[model samples]
Target: MGKKAEILERLGGIAPALRRYSRALCAGAGHTLSDELVQSALQSVGARIRARELRPADLQEARLEAYAALTASAGKRLTDASRPTPRHPPIVHGLAELSLDDRAALLLVSLEGMGYDAAARVLGIRREALLAQLMRARAKLGVVGLPPADAESGARRAASHLRIVK
Candidate 1:
């Protein structure tokens, strides 16, 4: 295969992982966001590959760059994914509790599966600072109500409804 084809193949291999990461990144929001984020990230990465801005030796770097691009894109919009969420807990609460930088830091590292160094690079911050932001974000997550036990039940119901729709 040609170099461009080879790179596309490699990116395709990583797409499922990217989707899982994106889902977790936008967890507690809406289902549509997971698809949107993954699509955006892949498109950004594909563009970079097509432009030859990323080399084979730098695939991981390219992935991180793509993730950063995705997050930056997210930062620009008022994207309310059309998926209707439960009214009781308020969809925006957990996210709103976080400072934007902290939320971005948490999502990139924890949900997007970007390593600390990679996430730090994406956020243009030192690893230590990124960790601190993540810590703060996690702490803030606890203040919200839903509680751990109820989350599973609620998730199951949501999953059942989602599956029915599908």
Candidate 2:
């Protein structure tokens, strides 16, 4: 294949993961916005690749670059004052409550399954800072281990609200 075709192929391989990450990143913003973010990231990466500004040595490197681009795009969107707030699911609302840095840290590690070093590189932060962000994000999301009694009651209360529909 030609160089352009090869680049396209490489990008295609990582597109699914990018979509998933974008969805998680834009959780409360709706799928349309998430999809737009993915498209924007793809275009940015493509341009860089064509301009010889970003030359990935491997698929993993390419994926990280794409993620970094998407995260940057998400940050820009979050800072736009004219953007309207929309209602989202409880879990999405919880994610939206997090600061951009906290959300990016939490999602990159937990949702994208990136290592601390790789995720830190993507966020342009040190490993220690990344760990601190992860801790703060987890604490904010109430991801701590609850006591046995509280766990049982919390589980029961959560289960009580469940309904089965045919």
Candidate 3:
């Protein structure tokens, strides 16, 4: 495969995970914000590639960078009006109790099935820091499963119901 193709292939392999992670990063902000975050992150990655700042070999790093940057940016951009009452009230309640960093760590490792080191890289944190956040998240999650399967299905159903406006 050519360099561009090889890089895109690597990104494609993790596209679903990246989407999942992006939404979970700021779950309380509502799907609209989370979806936009993913779009922005993808555009950022493409921009970097076009600028020749990101080489094909840096796909994994780029993926991590994109996610981390978007998460941070989302924190700043999220507004009170944009905040939705957590749809799964109970689950969202539990997650709401944890810090954003903790939630991100927990979801990256448990929700996305990422290894501790990989999750840390994505968060731009040390493995030890990731472990601490993960531990905190796990404790909080005892009350709320990290990746609520039903929540995901509900999201998918909602997406299916969306109609394009002319």
Best prediction by lDDT: 2
Answer with 1 or 3, whichever has the higher TM-score: 3
Ranked by lDDT, the better of candidates 2 and 3 is: 2
Per-prediction TM-score to the true structure, in the order listed: 0.66, 0.77, 0.72
Q: Per-residue lDDT of 21-96 in model 2, one digit per residue for the tens?
A: 7776775566687788888888888888888888877667777888999999998886433232554445455566
After superposition, which runs of candidate 1 have C-alpha atoms over 4 Å from their true positions? 2-4, 27-29, 79-84, 87-96, 145-166
Q: Which segments of model 2 are wrong by more than 4 Å? A: 2-7, 79-87, 143-166
Error of 2 at 68 (Å): 0.3
How many angstroms is residue 61 displaced in model 3 relative to the true structure, after the best TM-score fit? Answer: 3.9
**Which candidate do you rate higher for lDDT, 1 or 3?**
3
Can you tell me which runs of candidate 3 are displaced by over 4 Å? 9-15, 79-89, 143-166
lDDT of 1: 0.62
- lDDT tens string, model 3, 22-80? 66666566667777777777777777776888775667776776777677776677654
Please write out the lDDT profile of model 1 over residues 5-102, one tens digit for every residue: 77676776666666655544454455576677778878877887888876645457666766676666656642444323565243245655566688
- How accurate locally, in lDDT, is each candidate? 0.62, 0.72, 0.65
